[model samples]
Target: MAGKFEISRRSNGEFQFNLKAGNGQVILTSEGYSARSSCENGIESVRRNSADDARFQRKTSSNGKHYFTLTATNGQVIGSSEMYADASGRDNGIRSVQDNAPAAAITDLTAA
Candidate 1:
């Protein structure tokens, strides 16, 4: 789970994780941050990336919004979300990206 982005409970029953994106968007979060870290990870996941690669990438949407993608190897149809922005809209969009990354991770395998 070193390269994988996730929030797991430590033996002490605390949340610990490396909040990150392939590009360098990362943070240090705690138990209360599980939801938030998950959100960040979700955004990183939905930014249109490869399943085999552990690093996450940031992508853009048709509306010119920066976002991310999460891909899984099961060949399923996961959902998508947007990346953060300087404005509230961007933050909201990125929030969606976080919420949808896990779902998006289940999408079909992209072409090599």
Candidate 2:
């Protein structure tokens, strides 16, 4: 099965999206946007930026968990991964995003 993007409204009424891998694991999550259109644009940005390794910023939290953020050409973050136990897992998550995002189908849960 191919990966997919799931868009939904937040409890706060904003919009956000998650990129799920073929096995149904969420590889990346986007920040909340005031408008659904902005959230959709963020998904497109991820599709475009995921192709570039440089667009992925790998980082470690102060407690030492590994994670990564995907950024657009202007340097704004498009999405981020959940904290991983190790760098290897974080790297795998990045690879998953790269492999899956470009052609991922969008499932808009926001629609009634």
Candidate 3:
């Protein structure tokens, strides 16, 4: 199975998406957007930025957990990883995006 982007709507009626690896693991997730087109644009941004190592920003939460964000060339955040228990897990998430994002497919699970 190839990696894919799964688009869906939040309960509050905003749009969001998840980038899943070929093995079906969610490597990254997006913030809510008011419009579906903006969500799609975020996905495209992930695809474009995932190839660049410098575009990824590794961060730590206030609780000390690690995570990462995929940012566009112009510095916009496109996607983010789940909070991880350690730096290794966070790095794995980054690698997952780097490996799976370029060829990932889109799976729209949003309600009509």
Please tell me which predicted candidate would have the highest lDDT against the true structure: 2
The order by descending lDDT is: 2, 3, 1
What TM-score does candidate 3 get on C-alpha atoms?
0.92
Candidate 1 lDDT by residue in tens digits, 1-112 = 1122444555654444433333334322223224544544443533443333333234666666665433434433223333445345544444543533334322111112
Report the number of backbone clashes for model 2.
Answer: 0
**Candidate 3, superposed: residue stretches over 4 Å from native:** none
In angstroms, the error of model 2 at 29 is 0.4
Off by over 4 Å in 2: none
**Residues 1-112, candidate 3, lDDT per residue (tens digit)?**
7899999999999999999988888889999999999999998888888899999999999999999998888888888899999999999999999988888888889755
Alpha-carbon lDDT of model 2: 0.97
lDDT, residue 112, candidate 2: 94
- Candidate 1 residue-pair clash tally: 12
How high a TM-score does candidate 1 get? 0.25
Alpha-carbon lDDT, every model: 0.39, 0.97, 0.91
Q: What is the alpha-carbon lDDT of model 3 when measured against the actual structure? A: 0.91
